[model samples]
Target: MTTRARPAIAAMAYHQGAFVPFAEAGLPLTTQALQYGTGVFEGIRAHTCADGGKLVLFRVRDHYERFLRSCRLLRIETGHTVDELVEITCELLRRNGTTADTYLRPLGYKLALLPGTRPGVGLSGVSDALSITGFPMGAYTPPGGIRCTVSSWVRPRSAAIPIHAKVTGGYVNNALAADEARAAGYDDAILLDDRGRVCEASTANVFAARSGRLLTPPATADLLPGITRDTVLALAADLGIETAEHELDVSDLRCADEVFLTGTGIGITPVNEVSGHPIGAGEPGPIARSLAHHYARTIRGGGDVRHHHWLTSVRIDQG
Candidate 1:
């Protein structure tokens, strides 16, 4: 007997207040979020659990907390509590029937239809909106390791903009640096702050290891306080590794024993070379490999009881 193939799950999204076909989702061209980049967003990952046919969202509560902080910074009144948003995201994933590694994006934005209003200059009559979308995603960095260069562009000062907030407008600065890096024949870029101190990579936070201890830029370095960065720190402590948060210099990376980038999208990716200098044996270092392995296991719900709280399972049966 022959069996018929099941139909694919239709791409779906949660916008405003309801689910809609992905292709049918739309917003006004004059939206303040669109015209002036007045929005904040987060990138979250979900992994298939080892013991069941369920997807586990990594650090959902932490992501939502950060999202709300971004909204408060941007004055976008999403009005939904963290629990409500988590429920919406879980329902969206259930509808999509995603079973592989997936990326979920939740955005809170100014929804006003002001054509030419600049960001932070408009009157108090605008509206706010939120949307959640998910899709299959894979490794954002190349296998093995990546090459990086120090970009000519500098990160925006915290005084000029709340650099910790994931505001859409702020990413233009990241884009410029990334583009410059790619054009100059590098896989990624490392940005510096106004004072020439190391800030972070184009899209992720930076970490360097020397003599077995881990070092990352301080919160005052004008970069996103990445959730993944926090996860790495926690995992490192559990593994009996020491960590330090302080100002870093470009020369520090050039002389470091190892380097890696961490974020929701990239996870923990090693840097083999920086600005033409080879890092520790010119490969993924031992410390990075250990942390990456632990991180992978924790995210996939693989016998790590300590991190069980980090996963939010999305199974139709549970609902």
Candidate 2:
């Protein structure tokens, strides 16, 4: 019954085109992004390296690439390249004096004040805005593990709305599903697609292990296609564990040897139960634990050399 943790706000944040005091980083109430949820954002994690006390941003380029794609899908112009966004984010962290594990949120949004919901229509004066902010962050999921229930809410299909984009409006559906789960005393909820197949958790990609192999719902299942999920699959393959992408059912989760969720925010969180049914031994399974350990090591600039390519160092000389 524990709630998710959020870091305290930092003193400085990058807003529009300049760094400003966090209190001054405000948008107009009538902005189109606020009015109609026409915004795209990415959540990236930065970690402190034990060696040389360096700070490292994980997968900055990949996140920005996805961010740009999301902006394009929403017709919001970022006006910045992936490299520029990375540099902006790095500068934001540097100016904020970040020294510990932190989370970076970069957002692109339409800033017009028009009232109608017609996207890309009747907007002659609208402009796009971008912002990057960061703060200390910790585990997004509860420790030990979490219990999840299947949400009554179904994921929106791609035809109805581009399901691949991390559009702001779409997350209201996630908030509803998560609120329902929390109200019911569960840690989180698993969403299903229109076809009644397992899609993902409220904010993370879902994975289940059976017969020592890992399986997750395909991208077509309306999941976010998380970077952490990709990292886990790679780590699993390196560990000699097989992985596959396919459709899943709640029964598949209940009967699996292990169940877990992955994301930049949550890392690898074991699911001990689903819909009141205990999964396997009702605890974190061996495969999930191994993947979590490997992920932690890799993110902190440890583990395999190949994994090091994913990190972007933020340690700059202050002199």
Candidate 3:
């Protein structure tokens, strides 16, 4: 896929109940979510179609479904249904007139304590707010591949937090893990569960290809069930590639033919090295390359008709 230059952030955003200038979309200092990290969010992408005629959002409904699920976990009410959120996202894209690859972040969070409510970090007494902002972004991962470190931070299990949900507060674990990896000169981090098994990467799902079959941890392994990871599994089935969901250890990845990470932001990126050792040939492997090619096309209305259903088209508002 051809990469585009990172464009300036859009000047508009969906704030509260209406679209507004980006500068006007700020939350107050007393916002409960800001103080307590009581928020949920989804990172969605919009791509210019192969013909460059218009922009299409990949799995927009699925993202919102997951977004709502996270909000429900946090007791945050978005006041918008899945379909309504989809339309609002399309309208936001149209208003921005974005013509390149873009990333959208929809955030639902606790606003403040409701009137007559006592001051506390309790979710029951807080008001809720939702906002979405978008900006241009291309493939953020290195095209060649990336090196990762087995992080010292252990991933929190569902017992400690809702590991399946994209809770804003839970990301502190991811941030610290990623920072440790970067400080060690690695591109990312692979986190292990309390049981000392591979759970996922800092912010993405981890996969290892062995004997032409793909293996990844089950959702019970204390990782967010990623939409992109689901897409890859479906696409692999279409390609007649076998897959299994099971626990994997560091030794498993070290011995596998290839290791890769999948997510909405980074797409599919190969892990060339881990903890100072090369994974396989220490480069992007054939399976990852093939899947990445197909993923790029599938997001842009390519492949089968069924795949096109995952895309939501929006015409640019040139006026």
Candidate 4:
């Protein structure tokens, strides 16, 4: 049967061994990642860097490092090392000639399938396959700001699953909450922890500023300790904004003067609503704006000298 055509956006994908049109980037129905979410992946971002007058990948190494850790934990073999993954990502972007905001995804998936069959429903460790894909992406909230709801779904406790590994299956839980929000006439969703505490956005880590202190969920809250999350914590310190990470409940979120979300795919998005109540003036706040501006400039190789550790320039071969 002829495959349905992919729109221009997803038609071409960087697939197994090389770039291929979407119709050709096919795998057998028994693929492990397809069956059970036996896969690990990372969401990476490339920003327009002032230093090189080009889009610079932000903390690509860190993301790859985490990727390696995830593969190790998930018992899947990622054919390439973290460094190799970084090289492949940069090359893919180079080929795409993307200069504006772009997103990178490198996934390591189980390959050796068990004889029993069902796509999207298996959970045994087998062999692995690694694939990388890239696309030009725009802003998450477009800086204008967006509203989000506190999801009825709560993040599973650590006893339930590993939140740090970024397993593809973990996001099925995320997608569920996100889909619920859209169905309810909202753009995004926020999840609480199993203990009924604020956790994170459906797809991004959440943060807020109140009493002049920058506050976020402690790593225990089931939120991914995001790379951008780390950046903001340190960025807040540099800006002399007191930063704190602790268990935050819904009341704290509702009463906070300002709220925001952060992730690789969506730098920093203001949270205008929580549990249907409008967040602080219902607009992006001063601290969110400051951090966003500083983050935009910092990722582009500006002001901070010590943070150079976060950036990697695209070094191409002379072939």
Candidate number achieving the greatest TM-score relative to the actual structure: 3
Q: How high is the CA lDDT of each candidate model?
A: 0.87, 0.87, 0.91, 0.79
Question: Each model's TM-score?
Answer: 0.93, 0.95, 0.97, 0.89
Clashing pairs in 2: none
Error of 2 at 71 (Å): 0.7
Provide the lowest-lDDT 10-residue window in model 3.
1-10
- State candidate 4's TM-score: 0.89
Candidate 3 versus truth, CA RMSD in Å, comes to 2.2
Candidate 4 Cα deviation (angstroms), residue 16: 3.2
Model 4 residue runs over 4 Å out of place are: 1-14, 19-23, 51-53, 114-125, 315-319
lDDT of 1 at 284: 94
lDDT of 2 by residue, 1-319 (tens): 7776656987899998999999899987868778877788999999887475668888889999999999888777878999999988888888877677889898899897444445554334568899888889967676589999999999888787677888888999899999999999999999998888999898899999999989999976677898988899899989999999979998899899999999998999999999999999999999999999888888889879988899998874444
lDDT of 3 at 133: 95
Best candidate, lDDT-wise?
Answer: 3
